[model samples]
Target: MEKTNSASRFVDLVQTKKSFEDIKYWTWSEMLIALKQCQESPSLTNSSIMLKKCIDLLSQKISLADGASSSASSVNSSRFRSSCDSKSTESLKTNFASTTWWFEDLLFFSTECLEMFVQSMVSHEFDQVLLSKFLIHFQKSKFFNATSDVKMKVIESVIDMLDTLDENVLSLKALFDILRVTLGLNINKGSKNRLEAMIGSKLGHATLDNLLVPSPYGANYLYDVNLVLRLFKAFLSGGINQASPSQLAKAANLMDSYMVEVAPDPCLKSSKFLALAKVIPDSARKSYDEMYYAIDLYFEMHVGMSEEEKEKICCALNHKKLSYEVRIHLSKNPKFPLKSTPSSPESQQPETENLLQNINYSKSLISWPHNLTEGINTDEKEDKSSEQIVLYHGKFDLPADNERFKVHLEGMQWRVLELEKLCRKMQTQMRKILKSRVASSYCQVKSLPKLCS
Candidate 1:
């Protein structure tokens, strides 16, 4: 009975040590299971805390393994330099290579743990601080600093995890910070330029749209419009031509929306807007036009006196006169024909001239009543006839017999009388100025002639 009791105690001791050993090297999957179990248990809050600590410790061990592997690799490489010709050196190299593989496996395992933990934390509503710690660990991991292929895989994993996270629990600041860091590293290494086109292609429009235009917080929109604008600008500036057509389209759409919401003041300038306009694809022209119209409307609404004033404002909005020029260009395209294309050579030669003639005739028709209010003098009639002669050239021929034409002619006649009265008013002011100038000149000339005589 005493021996059996001792044997049972020994078995229990062995089991406890094994449990401790298992915790020390806990796989990510095991840690997750333990965490879930602790979460479910009523009296396991302390156990959960302890498990978290264990997971953290395991993460540290993984980091140490990386450092140890790097050091070992360096040492092995040095040994090759010292003893290249020795038989033992070959054996040492083989052994070192195998050891390195073991370290790599450990790192791979740790990466798996990190990925799972990130997903778990995101899903389970872990503390922001804990999530941040996980992100920091992730950023510091060997997987993050791996080859482009490897890093992209890790990035994809993170993005997938992002999809699963609850919006309320997801830490925007933390995510942004991680993205910023990753982007910085990519930028530093010149990998971001290569990755951008791929990111656009893989993520597609909907994902990007969601990221850029998230739900509004208070008055603040999802992402900072300015920041998102800058990010897209950076991506395009890097080498957007390499991106897929859909990616280019998505980028242009986002940029168009961003320009409207943020209304980048710099983009209104000649040099900047011109530079960016070149990159906008044909697929996104409609979006660009909409943004342009919105900006035009905004300026008109905010600055103009009336709708007519707004029309004038629209004409002047683009500093480079690009708006009208672009309209003409678009109108000329075979795909989008102009609404009022002049078929005849005569009609085409002077649309503006014809428009001006119509405008003058309309003005004459409207001004008839005003002429009657003010009387015309004799000198003013000669000036009025000269103006009427100018108005009647080549185009603008009036019909002689139609009742409507007769009414229009009568109105124009009244306007001519009004013009004569205005001419008389202007003639009186001009005559007075001329008299003063002539008197002064005459006095000077007379004095000059007297002096000469």
Candidate 2:
């Protein structure tokens, strides 16, 4: 008890700093070295005392960077600029606009340590974008040539902190990169499925290349067709009510391009290829030319496909949606797949369902922005309950037509875009001010060299 009291007394003095009249404060360089020493000792880094101190020091470093850009001086010894990795230091000199200078410093830590470290950062209420950017950087570096097992661990670690991020902070490309790395890895099936679901929720925004995931080793196929199929199913699982027509169109077109790229793989089975093609609804395809060419490519590569198999492949296409040139080409081929037989009802069932579901979905969508601004600014249930109360108490009638409702949402979307632009403008002005402060801070240093050569 006496020893504890003495140690506590020293800690309090170091923390409070009121009694120390003469002190030589450690630079961020020194503090960072100390922090790294603690991080290397897992026991110390995990402990509350060490973790809190590390968090406090990191917060100050970031604050210092934010308070002053590196351009403030040709050189400085006091803060983070001189203390961090040399590459990071040089990068900072060139990129004065970015306040996130610490992202590069923590890239070398193990995934387990990063998980704990990132969780700690999240707890400290660090900037959400900072956390997200670090995760992205970590993902890219670790997943570069990591084995399947290592990739799984990385995914698991990233997923934990990724949950804390607000929507849109992490880009779809980054998520797709993670998905690509995680694919074909022998991880838990449930975890992979969940990852697919998470990525699918935003798959509408995915570029065509994002869907081109390669098959695992030993597979004859060039790409993992099954993964794309599962992703498409997950994307559609939310139904038309959740996805606007434009988003659906984007996904369908992206899948069409993906099929075209993978169609030449002779080992790709007809059933697997057709399944993905058929999953796309007819209304979603503005043009079937790409789909037709993909089917044609598959036919050329795998000529042994039976008549029924060929018909099944061609059924994914809506002849009416095909352009004049494609229709002419299909008409000329004697063995053209579509020429085998008309699309049977079984083959067209998914499209019919999609159209009917879309009509029902149009009527069921919420008129206001409940779905739009969900999980924002208020507790979801309370926000919805309050909205209902307003509707019940005041005679407010929502637009019944989907078009009018979409217009309202679009208007809100435009206002959001305007606000985002305004926020960006404000950030630019603030950075300019910070840059000026950096310039002023340089002028105040009396011992500084006469001029930087």
Candidate 3:
């Protein structure tokens, strides 16, 4: 009878519309024990209802506490605003004095409630607003600045939440906020500068170098590149070398692959392209040259133009006196070689001069190829077989493969060398064309009679 009365009192408490503070008298473990006993009994309809009420009250209390703690301190009146404004300008000094003790209490309560809530078997709807509030509060705590043991607890809680959450509308925003906080802390300039300065003068450079290399951090390579590129552009514009030789080389390699996938719509802004070119190191100039070669090759193969015809069109287009319509018409012809023979001596004089000018332009294009060749080595290493060598007439020789195999190997080597030569040649010609275009613009600006005509 005493037990029955105790059960009745528990049911009455559950059914009552008690504030969360009132329910706090019953520990979560005790509540769970009561709830389990009620679920086991067949006649406890009121007990089941009471159990749900208790869970709801606990959840709400946890949520409310989290909200009260984490939100930015509000300035409700002119007096409060004046008080805050009159405080120290530095955040550290201000936060130390103005910090609320209630926030710590709230976090403690919420953490306990959350642990209890997870243990309950009740299917409760995740309160997104409440979760967001908790996260906002957590960030405000600057929990990382705390003792390592406390920091570990916070980090563990965050990781657990990240793993379990459904990542729905409510959860995704919370997760993004968490990620922002983590990344912000790691890459914070003030924190990084102090640590780096303590190590050595090359601290910043070393940090950037590690970021460029492949690792877990490389998972964010695209983001890193974008951030670095912005920094690099600022440096270039300010005439500073923000990137090292190897860093620029890595960037060049990335750009080589990136440019191929980029659409060639002239309307698209390519400020990154210009910035990349400016920041690339002299050592990695070959990579940039190769990229330009590939671009030219892509245009040639896809745009239906032979090498000779492209040369002719490029040369003619660079002439200051050439009209756009005339150039376009000339480019449309299949056999309009710039140096084709003239019919008469009277016509040949002007044609000869034009021919000489085109020859000189072609000679200029060859200069880049010569410069590229000066630093390149095309020697092939000899292959050594592990098999025993047989002496024939005092000369040591291994057993030879079929004649066709030897021929195929030689052909493959020749093709690779040929392609390399072609790439260099095309790069040189493209550079010359670009240079000529600049010169033509300058001549037009000067209003030279021969060019302006």
Candidate 4:
């Protein structure tokens, strides 16, 4: 009998809390140990149910005590217990249990216990925002520098938490941090694919700095190209693209900037660079000037990088899309393999051809005041092209129009600046022509006088 007692005590795990009617009587560590043991058992679901009920009991007790406290302060300093205590009225005790009553205690739980707790809270339909904040707070308390085996457990729990979150409210920085932590763990890629999707869905909202997830030490590449590549593919795969061109543009532009930043790293390979650069469709970018700039930077740092590779990279840039300044720069770039002459009709229209027409750009820079009530008409009057307006937001609550409206406004501003520059150049040329004609007329007048003599 003593040996049997010793065997059971050796395990020291409390498998069930069926006896604890009020969880306030159960110590924090006692509950933690009990839950951890429950996680390994077949009756996990029942244990979770019991754990939740215990939490509910604890909240009711605390809340009721708080409400029924000694607000009626008279001469009440006696320590003797009242034998015939009267129950507080419903009006005095709201009996309201807070959802966050369990958040603090959850901090000490292992990843497994925390995940199960989160699942229970979510099943109860708690406010997702509050829950997400608690998770973020819980994350800050964890030791990220823990062993690979430990990190893998943490990452798995994080991914599970991410799965339960509303993507709209999922913090992008937190997502990035999770990926950053997994860099050297060498865990199975399949496990993190969900993380890629989570990051991708909201890729448009991400900043350049956040996208710059570096490769772990000993990695041949300077940055984690494959990770970002998967994210890019996942972003495109998700149907969020239907929303607006501007957000798509934002992602493409972000990728372009990322390319530029990573280009200078000597260890980065040409194929990897192209892999990321090519993920953004050609039509998404407003212009290839940034892409061209990134390619140029890549070529500059990687001198031995093959001419064929340079040509392949340059081929991705549509010459017509290159800004006038970029065209000039590319033409002068010694390494640039000039396939087509820089004098393309699309790049520069003859002055006489377009001089007759004032608003001669592709689309008039007019503000097409599209009313939200009016259904979007995508006919020739509204071809579903790059300029098609989509919903976006800026400072404060945006008007019924989306952020695409902001994109249109920015395009108009750029066109206005270009027009302004053209006007200044025309004024200078006109002044020069008038000065030359005057000098010729004066000479002719002097010659006429000489002829008369």
| Top candidate, metric lDDT | 2
Candidate with the greatest TM-score versus the true structure = 4
Q: Enumerate residue pairs that collide in model 2.
A: none
Clashing pairs in 3: 70-137
**Cα lDDT computed for each candidate against the true fold:** 0.44, 0.64, 0.40, 0.62
Q: What is the C-alpha RMSD of each candidate to the true structure, in Å?
A: 19.8, 27.6, 25.6, 18.1
**Model 3 residue 183 lDDT score:** 48
- Angstrom error of the Cα, residue 46, model 3: value is 24
Residue 343 lDDT (model 2): 43
lDDT: the better of candidates 2 and 3 = 2
TM-score of 2: 0.55
The lDDT, on a scale of 0 to 1, for candidate 1 is 0.44
Clashes of 3: 1
**Global fold similarity of model 4 (TM-score):** 0.60
Candidate 2 weakest ten by summed lDDT: 366-375
Better of 2 and 4 by TM-score: 4
In model 1, what is the error at residue 19, expressed in angstroms?
A: 14
By TM-score, is 1 or 4 better?
4
User: Candidate 2: lDDT of 167?
Assistant: 57
Looking at model 1, residue 225 earns an lDDT score of 45
